[model samples]
Every structure is written in C-alpha cells, then in structure tokens.
Target: MEHEMRAEYEEGVEPGPDAEVKNWHMVRRDGIKAMCGRMLSESAATQPADRWGEPEGEPFCFLCGAVYLREVP
Candidate 1:
C-alpha cells in the first residue's frame, strides 16, 4: 500500500532557547499536519532525510504514535 503518513516536527524560532521544544509527530504524507492534530511547519523536514530513527530518547508525541500504529496495516 502506498504510504499516507510521515514523520514531522517543529523546527524554528517558536522553539527558542527558553521555549520548550515540541515533540516529533506522525503526520499525513500529503500534508503538514500531525496525527496528534498539531499543525507542523512548512519548513519542517520529513523522515528518512531527517533520519529520526525510532523516537527513543528523543521527545516524541505519544498520541501521534498511538494513532499511527492503529492506522497502520
């Protein structure tokens, strides 16, 4: 099946030195919005190229992961 989902995260000034950084989210492959309902930035890079192997120690959106797993075939 053709994939309809991708990984995304916030990467810009909004997450400044003082601001808490947002977690990576699983999003629709065709759009910039995350499965957790958060709208990712247009500048946010997608997976593979981002090389974000399993969220692991990195901050990630649990909600997005839950939804993504449920949606997967």
Candidate 2:
C-alpha cells in the first residue's frame, strides 16, 4: 500500500527582511508526524493536498523527502 504525503508548515521568525518564512515538512496523510520522525505540534499549519508542492522558494525537509523517497512507493 502506498502512503499519501501531506505538507505542513513550520513557521519561524527570522532576523532577516523576511520576518516570517514557512518551512514545510512532508508527513503521512493520516498523521501529524513528519516522515523524518519529527512529531509536529498541534498548532502546526497545514495546507490542502493539492497545494503540497506549491510553496515557492521555501525549502522542504530534506530528511522527510529522503525517507519518503526510500520508503514510500
């Protein structure tokens, strides 16, 4: 069975001009934990499944992507 992927944003306040930038992490569709085994907080922000890859200029979690590529078909 193939596991569905979901994107959840972890917002952080930076010191640069871009005060708030969202770093999206890939997680299993049915759970809040990311593919890299990081448990997302209850307040984490989520997007529609269609918008998973639409975050331009924002980086994805490398560990999550790596695990997804290796484990999810």
Candidate 3:
C-alpha cells in the first residue's frame, strides 16, 4: 500500500547544478517508444537490457541521457 501510494505521487525533477548524481535508473524504453514513436532502444554497443546492476538516485533516459529525480522519504 505504501509503495503504491508513493509511486502514485512520484514526480520527476531536475536536480540543481550543484547536486551530485550518485545513482541512476534508466527510463523504460518501451514507454519512450509509445510516447515518441521513435527507437531509442537499439544500441550501437551493448543493449540497455543487457546491462547489469541498477544504481540508485536519479532516474534517466538511457537513450537520451535525460535525468529525472524524486526525493525519497
């Protein structure tokens, strides 16, 4: 219940210039495709899904490198 409520209220914010990025979560590639109708998933190198170990902190678009952050707690 708590998780659902938190997720419902989650809003993305752009961190300040002085803020340091300690972690990152890649935005869903599928959602991007649906919204923009463009392919940001296919990688010239390793596929995004093929990557390992998700970090914490800022949420980012893996394809475009746009970062979004939400405060937890």
Candidate 4:
C-alpha cells in the first residue's frame, strides 16, 4: 500500500538568511527512504520510537509532530 507524506516548518529555527523557504512537496517511496536515511545518518543518537519504528516505515517528527511518508506524484 502507498503512503502519504507531510512536512511542516520547524519551530524556533528560522530559515537561514540565504535559505529559500518553499512548500514541502510529495516525493517517491525511495526518495522518502533516502531522505530519512540521510537524517538518521546525520544524527548521532538513535531515533526515537515516534520517529523511527522497529521496521522503519513512515514516522512522525517528534519536534513538530508531523508525519512523513511516500506520496504519489
């Protein structure tokens, strides 16, 4: 089954001076996996249960409580 992806602005941290704030768009399954992988790789600590499940499917961001998933284009 396919999934739905959603993103929201992180709190406190404003977009960088040169950062161009844009709407978060839906990406593919592989793309979502890659994105999550990169995020995990950057973090030194293990992801929380809310962010990373045992099987590593779509997870919600604890910081913003936003859910992430693969979205159909």
lDDT by residue for model 2 over 1-73, one digit each (tens)?
3344434433453234333434556666656787778766544555443444465424667787677677645
- Residue pairs clashing, model 3: none
Most accurate candidate by TM-score: 1
For each of the candidates, the C-alpha root-mean-square deviation to the true structure, in angstroms, is: 5.1, 5.5, 13.6, 11.0
Better of 3 and 4 by lDDT: 4
**Per-prediction TM-score, please?**
0.60, 0.54, 0.20, 0.19
Candidate 3 lands at a TM-score of: 0.20
How would you order the candidates by lDDT, starting with the best?
1, 2, 4, 3
Model 1 residue runs over 4 Å out of place are 1-21, 49-57
Candidate 4 lDDT tens digits, 1-73: 3332333224433444442222232222323332333221111112232323323323344332233423212
Kindly report which residue pairs in candidate 4 clash with one another. none
Candidate models: Cα lDDT each? 0.55, 0.55, 0.27, 0.30
* Superposed Cα deviation of residue 41, candidate 3 (Å): 22
lDDT of 3 by residue, 1-73 (tens): 0110000112343344343432333334423231112322221112243232344322433423322123212
Reference-based lDDT, residue 60, model 4: 41
TM-score head-to-head 2 vs 3, winner: 2
Cα deviation in Å at residue 46, candidate 1? 1.6
lDDT of 1 by residue, 17-63 (tens): 35444566666665777778888766554453133335431466778
